[model samples]
Target: MTGTEPLEGAAPAVGAPLLEATGITKRYGRYTALDAVDLRIEAGRTVSVVGESGSGKSTLARVIIGLERPDSGSVRFRGEPVRGRRARRAFRHSVGMVFQDPYESIDPRLTIGEVVAEPLRAHGLYRRDGAARVRELLDSVGMEGVDPDAYPHRFSGGQRQRVCIARAVATDPELVICDEPTSALDVSVQAQILNLLLDLQRRRGLSYLFITHDLEVVRRISDEVDVLLRGTVVERGTAEQVTSRPQHEYTRRLLGAVPAISPRQRRIGAPLISDAPAVPDSKESTESKESKESNSA
Candidate 1:
């Protein structure tokens, strides 16, 4: 790949794909994590990658963010090759990441302000009056007036996630990679976080590379969906189209597994009663009803 300079500005030209990866491949010893994966993200749009565990979703994210170099193929940002120090620095400035686990992604020792300001410090973008910027960032994510001296452990799971998001956007990056960002939170808190992301995108015109396993979450947030299986993209299309009318067998099976509500069930607000036989309940039994229910979803 040729070394080329990225655009100085964070935003891409209107209607252009901000990031593109073509024929990307990666392998670990005998196992391939990705196989000739091609993906694109348009400016100011959300493109989601969905797959089961070990399906190479995380590998793709790592490659895009420059954490892992692909064994083959190329990555481009704003129509330029992401090669050499300057180009990579430009890429880092243009892209931000919100990792899967808020608890582990952040350092417990650092105060909230220091954690959020780390990106600015790395890029030499920190200002002498940077405390104002920190406050503004926190307010943007709905955490106004939070004490800058407070450590991460003082915050709840959802609050820690908010701080993480605050840090990711500190540089006002054009693209954000969200890797299963809400998977660790409770269902109610997940909704709030999703809405916060949506608001941020709307206000900043940010493009998102959202990686998750939940199709329902994909349906809610993505403009397009790419379904990966065994390190290859099995199917891709508009979110509604892919989820509603999958063409590949793998895609079909994945969609089929989603718990759906039938028309009758919707009308009754519950599933139809079945006459199936119940399992014999005993304290000494190996199987428990709670265990079965826990594994249902």
Candidate 2:
């Protein structure tokens, strides 16, 4: 996902990526949160970034979506630099985000109609028909016929997440950075949300930079996967290649750590460098990426 090279025989990405981050490094004091990280998301594809907690996954997510800027790197959306007020405003409208917790992300004071229509209002999109568009988005996320005047607290967790999805896609964003949007839900509800996201992606052609620690979820949803150890990417490939045939010790250990529910759990053997010297933990730092928030819902 780092390189800009096109696949053999495949046409070029045309002009530039829908979204690209290159040589991204974010440092807080002596700690390097992101170490020369690079990621590219093409149109209509899901490139999942999978790592354990504190692996800088959220930092990367924030940087990509314009909530935070890297200390030494560049982020481009549709070939436009995501800097300055004007460019950032354009970036926010082009990209949407779904946070990990639906309840906390939505404002308690806002009704479902307001929550979904907020993005439209921010971007001045669908202005005259905002209410109709909100209903369409709600219906699209499987919350049709519900009272748009209802508050966030009245909805169940899954229902709230549906509303979140409706808001995220309200402005017809080309890319969506989903930061563990399903991790907080029950297993059944998680499945439902995942399916809804996939359906929306299919209908809207929305690219996704899905951030998660769950390898199982990655395999189910991602076309390509990046395995992050600490902060840097240790392995990258198709979901089948990276998950089933991991080439890094850290990735192998992660695969091994997954819970086995059956007697016949498949084993992913260690890498050839299993006996090699242990790699040092990435010199990473942590800070809230929520500062300098964009106009996303």
Candidate 3:
């Protein structure tokens, strides 16, 4: 539980686990989106969760940010159980998010500055210095050209995403859960957004629970990764270890699906391929799949 134990369920970490979820179980009617999943995130590190479309990565993110509650299990923030309204509010303020579609995420009616400033206003973080702070934040994310009053529809997808990033960081959250944040952008734009996220993490010591099916992205942004298949974590390890030296069959299959690119980095500026195949049904215990469907219905 303390300072970067990195290993699992060993103790009450000294430095504290910024976010931890134990035996999290979620059922949508009959289908179980998550099954007894345990996760630990440390401050100032990026942890990628690699999975197919239906592997429950989105479900996990929703539960983490309190958008969805698990039927069973618990989520802890800084080692404190998060269940009450106050705790959920605290989670909202401390855990920011950037969704997949920038255009959909940003309001076309609002200016870039307005969009970024909304989080502060909603969280009551606005003060006498709010205006100045907004510009600084905008500039930091490279959307300085955007007039604080210029509407979101005037900007390109990449610029809009930058606005989203600025807004998510407005509360100065300790952790950012980016759910396919750049999936809608062009290749060059994706690189810019990805780099922006990395730079912010370095400058602010932010932790990230990045969800994506893109293995190359996992290597680029994560210090470590957890591969999920059929709603369960199948493999967990450092980026180099997980990406370069996969230990599980599922993990190997995921990596094998990655397109050939320069080993040094992803082939950015190329179109992104977020539409990867789901885990094989036969691989899942028939009981587990049937059990989840019962929950889903």
Clashes of 2: 1
Tens-digit lDDT track of model 3 for 1-297: 111113221223235689999988898877878888888898888889889899899899999898898999999998899989998988889988999988688878787777888989988878889999899898778765457988876566666677788899999999999998876665435665787888889899999999999897888778878888878887787888888877777778888997654433354544232321111123233224333423332
Candidate 1 at 148: error in angstroms?
Answer: 1.4
Query: Distance from true position, residue 157, model 3, in Å?
Result: 1.0
- Cα lDDT tens digits, model 1, 1-297, are 212122111222246678999999998987888888888899989999988888899999999999999999899999999999899998999899999888899998899999999999999988796888888888788676678889976666667788899999999999999999988765545666787888899999999999998887787788888888878887888788777777777777777676443555457754222211111123223123223322332
Q: Between prediction 1 and prediction 2, which has the larger TM-score?
A: 1
- Considering lDDT, which of the candidate structures 1 and 2 is the better prediction for this target? 1
Q: Where in model 1 is the C-alpha error above 4 Å? A: 1-15, 259-297
Best by lDDT: 1
Local error of candidate 3 at residue 270 (angstroms): 13
Query: What TM-score against the true fold does each predicted structure earn?
Result: 0.83, 0.82, 0.82
What does the lDDT come to for candidate 1?
0.79
Q: Between candidates 2 and 3, name the one with more favorable lDDT.
A: 3
Write down the lDDT of every candidate, Cα atoms only.
0.79, 0.75, 0.77
Please list the Cα RMSD from the true structure of every candidate, rounded to 1 decimal place.
11.0, 11.8, 12.0
Q: Which pairs clash (backbone N, Cα, C closer than 3 Å) in model 1?
A: none
Worst 10 residues of 3 by lDDT: 1-10
- The all-Cα superposition gives candidate 3 an RMSD in Å to the true structure of 12.0
